[model samples]
Target: MHRGFFGLLALGLTFAVPAAAADNLKITGDETVVTIETDDGVVDITRQKTEAALIGGVLQPMVPVPGVTPVGELEVLDALKTKSAKVVDMRTLEWRTKSTIPGSIHIPYTEVAMRLNELGCSGSQGAWDCANADKMIAFCNGPACPQSPTAIKAMAREGYPPEKIFYYRGGMQDWVVLGLTVAEDMF
Candidate 1:
């Protein structure tokens, strides 16, 4: 092997570290460890075990966008119950047809920036005044999915306050895994 490859291995760069605030998203006693028998030996792989893994997609970092608060199931529920926040499902229509978090509004990532008015921002698409933008929680298929992250960045670029944005990185994968409420008729 090349010396650089050995150096990379020695640096222990196998997995990406999830950003902080992940504790709020973990379900009780969730086990992420996986055991596999390799040709050379037995391997125990831990981390990168979100439900997104089962569905087959690249595992995303716990924090997609810096300065955005990352939240979980409980936080999502509380926010919905209190009517203190708007939970947005940033997936495309096809994905959303399967299932979604209850009370979350559908706002495909492709159109979020143009739809800021629906979020309480005034003015037109290019000249938005988001001073009154609502506090929003954005999510998609799972941490592996980029829809919400894309929407989030667009919102931020359009002057949506990062403080008013919360990211539910676990998304539908974690929500379904936890057996929380799912909304099937959300078009």
Candidate 2:
């Protein structure tokens, strides 16, 4: 009788130990580590969630564009050929180094404010030579990326006409997906 009781207790502990360890792995708002038992093998899941942006007392991810329609790849390419538009590649340094659209200018989001003058827009004269010379389209990584919108806002604040600014939300990812040619050298 005593031996049978001990054997049952040992069997219960074998299953309970793994359950407790699985529960211990979870950490909220930081990194969640979970052990999943599968038919084939055990799998571990670790995910780190990003913080949300606050807007009007509601938390949300930063949107790339508010209410503007993103121009198509063909449209942008045609504009480039006609000299009717210019593209400002707002991708990060690491991303830009990998690949970029041909003839696109490099203006990382963080540097847009300081480099506004380089766009050939004369702040002193209150004229946007680059933007006015042709439509100005800004792009970064992709639709989920927030850099391009920030760049557009910076340009607008610097007196680049809003009407002339077109946000290319599709960005470099879309450009490459469409099999567009990427320039190895920076413009």
Q: Score candidate 1 by lDDT.
A: 0.79
lDDT of 2 by residue, 1-187 (tens): 5546347656673322333333332243333455788654676654322232111111112333343346878777976788677788886777777788888888898887666666656554334444532367788776556678877776676666666767776777677777789887463
Cα lDDT computed for each candidate against the true fold: 0.79, 0.63
- The reply for model 2, stretches above 4 Å from the true place, is 1-69, 124-134, 185-187
- Give TM-scores for every candidate, taking all chains together and pairing residue i with residue i: 0.71, 0.58
Note the residue pairs that clash in candidate 2.
none
For model 1, the run of ten residues with the poorest summed lDDT: 20-29
Query: Which residue pairs in model 1 clash with each other?
Result: none
- Candidate 2 yields a Cα-based lDDT of 0.63
Best by TM-score: 1
lDDT of 1 by residue, 1-187 (tens): 5556346656775535445333223222343444578554666554534434424444566666678899998899999999899999999998888898878898999999899998889987778999998999999988667788888989889888888999998998888878788989679
Q: Candidate 1: misplaced stretches above 4 Å?
A: 1-55
Residue 46, model 2: lDDT of: 46
RMSD of 2: 13.6
